[model samples]
Target: MKLARATFTPGVLGGPGFFGGMFELPGGYLKPVLVSSCDGVGTKLKIASVMGKHDTVGMDIVNHSVDDILTCGAAPLFFLDYIAMGKLDSALVADIVKGLSTACQEVGCALIGGETAEMPGLYHGKDYDLAGFIVGIVEKDRIVNGLTIKPGDAVLGLPSSGLHTNGYSLARRVLGETPEALSKVYPGFDRSIGEVLLAPHVSYFKTLQPVMSDVKGLAHITGGGFTDNIPRSLPEGVSVRINTGTWDVPPVFELIQSLGQVAPEEMFRVFNMGIGMTVFVDPSHVSTMLAAMPQARVIGEVTAEAGRKVEIV
Candidate 1:
């Protein structure tokens, strides 16, 4: 229903082989500003190929991109995907599309267009890459650029649903990429290692809607984890001071830390360590936001001091 209304003509044009996607949005007096972001699923695809699970990676790309634009206070409108592989299989495409459609519907974003290619010279058997481009809209006045972020503001960390599409290369190097190795279950984890590693990334768009006004900035912790991502959402003179023991670091990270013999600081730099998303919220609204969203907790604060972007204790 959401997609059909925004599409220029449902199923008539747009998607692979078409020149482009046609979308219609009814603009009002609010003067909606468009926000867009593009991202790839990264080396996580290797794990998916080994496990023969193509669905979740599709979700990973969409959710990852959605969260990216959400930092700008935009609500996702539609999404487009690009998939390239060596051999194209109907079953494989179906699984991947299923995941994309599932994620798009969940967030009310239209999965109106996408491309799938078979490149024998470039990719090998089931090995492929996935990328997503998302466009969202927000009122210009409502943009959260972190300019308003300052000292005394509370930093809240949202629990991640496992790795959330990052640190996979190092994880692969540590956890072993073979089918048998992934199938091995370690102590404390009831499921196979592959399942934990393959878990799909979470979407915070809808969940953060209610408290959007109170949030001054948001950092989608990816690629560089807390160290790199948090700074992107901070102003010049302000930095984050995270209370390390505030939230439970998921066991999967501990497993990687132990098995890979990774140093503590490197783990925080390379992975989320538990928090998938961080919010710089107004102190006055902190309690209300926390009460509204039980899964989130006070993880740190904004410091007036400059220099280091993230200070962990």
Candidate 2:
């Protein structure tokens, strides 16, 4: 098999070691329940590459991909990645793979296979892009699409670690390039801008795994922040009202807001603000679910409306 012929040792390569080991279809035959999602690190890679920190990006890609399919309530089975750079460096690639392998292993998913490209001119030297494909499976009856989400459901929010792979384009513009500028630690931050911006995208698979089946819908707050991402999982006629002060905002967000003069509403629209993933659950299970997932807070509640609306307060 292709996995066997890989130049890296069986375990050294992501595919053979991480994802390939844990996932198996119910039957011996090839046909099986499958769910897949694809995503990239977005402009966050620019920060990593600029800082010469190629290590955490693999985590960003895997976590981002994992969150994409997790919206479907299916646990990840395996992941495949694509890495393209103007030139290839074994050390850099290894750092990326190490992060990928660590994430895949923690989530109990396989890092199945991928393609790496060393283009001549398409990419500027040392500048690269990463994308990942993830596959998951759920029973015919167990899939958790938002079809069941109804008005009056409780919206539980999982805290984000910062921007989490979104809004970096604007972020870079607001905060100019320079290690000294970036290295100046924001209040409450022991690290610098580079560290916060490069913070590995948080993975919710483990935290939400136990309660996945009980929730009606799940939303991964990504590029569009709560305004855009939350609606993707809402049923017709249902909207969400979020309390802005429900959780303490991470200081990094405050710095961005203060520096960019980012409006309160605009901040919520552009960044995770604080909440990363939101789960809509039935009233009956809300208490139990919140108790189980301590990292979550009752940020909002679902309601019937003409269209999906996200309220900051």
Q: How many steric clashes between backbone atoms does each model show?
A: 0, 4
TM-score for candidate 2, residues paired by index = 0.90
Question: Each prediction's Cα lDDT score?
Answer: 0.87, 0.80
**Model 2 residue 177 CA deviation in Å:** 2.6
- Residue 193 displacement (Å), model 1: 0.8
Model 1 TM-score, 2 decimals:
0.94
Pick the TM-score winner.
1
lDDT value, residue 30 of candidate 1:
82
Which digits, one per residue and each the tens of the lDDT, describe model 2 over residues 1-313?
1112122223333344432333445454243457898889888888887788887999989998888888777778778788888887778888888888888888877776666777868989778888888888776576778888887888888988899999888788888666676677777779888888998889998988888889888889998898898888887787888877778889888888999998887787789987889989998998899789978898888888748777667
Task: Encode model 1's per-residue lDDT on 154-259: one tens digit a residue.
Answer: 9999999899899999999999999999999999999999999989999998889888988899999999989999998888988789999999999999999999
Q: State how far residue 149 of model 2 sits from its true place (Å).
A: 2.0
